[model samples]
Target: MLRYSLMRLGIFAGCFLALWGLVYVGALPRGLGDSNLLWVLLLSLVISAPLSFVLLRKQRDSMSVEIVEKVDRAKGRLQDNRTREDAV
Candidate 1:
């Protein structure tokens, strides 16, 4: 899960930096006046969301599996404890 999260963050950071460069080079339009940074950040987020969804699909699936395994383990432990208590 952490791996997937970090990968997602990496993608966002990459998008942000690339967009920032484009804006700096005047290849991309900048936001009006004081909103320049805000504009770039929002645009980066919008671009990164779909990229992460497509690029990180495997990582996301593995994270989900990890979570399911943990939940199943916890449930099994709870059932074991309950049976032990009943036997006492």
Candidate 2:
């Protein structure tokens, strides 16, 4: 979970920096002027932050499901071992 959170943070930071750099380099047009550009960048960050968070959450959920399956398998093996020991 911690790793996933960090990964999402990294992705958000990278995207924000990339967009800022594009705007600075004149690759993207200014919304209207300095103020507009700032506003647009802020809006992009706001939107991207939540979208990334949701994506990370979905990824985490899938990971959790995989972990749960592994744990269940291990538990079953442990129970079988205990049963064999009892049979002896």
Candidate 3:
């Protein structure tokens, strides 16, 4: 999970930097007046979301499986405690 999170953040940062560079180079139009930074940030997030979804599919699936396993273990523990209480 931590690995997947860091990878997603890395993708977002990469997109942000690349977009900023493009704006700096005047290749992409800047947002009106004071909104250029906001524009770049929002656009990078939009671009990075789809990229992370596609690129991190395997990691995401593994994370989901890990979560489900943990939940199952917790439920088992709870049921065991309940059974012990009933037998007391």
Q: What is the C-alpha lDDT of each candidate?
A: 0.96, 0.77, 0.99
Residue by residue across 25-70, what tens digits does model 2's lDDT show? 8887667655755755586678678778677887888779988999
How does each model score on TM-score? 0.93, 0.47, 0.97
User: Residue by residue across 10-58, what tens digits does model 1's lDDT show?
Assistant: 9999999999999999999998989999999999999999999999999
Which residue window of length 10 is worst by lDDT in model 3?
Answer: 24-33
Off by over 4 Å in 2: 1-52
By TM-score, rank the candidates, best first: 3, 1, 2
Top-TM-score candidate index? 3
Better of 1 and 2 by lDDT: 1
Clashes of 1: 0
Each model's backbone clash number: 0, 0, 0
Best of the candidates, lDDT: 3
User: What's model 2's lDDT at 72?
Assistant: 100
**Cα RMSD (Å) between model 3 and the true structure?**
0.6
lDDT of 2 at 17: 77
Model 2 clash tally, residue pairs = 0
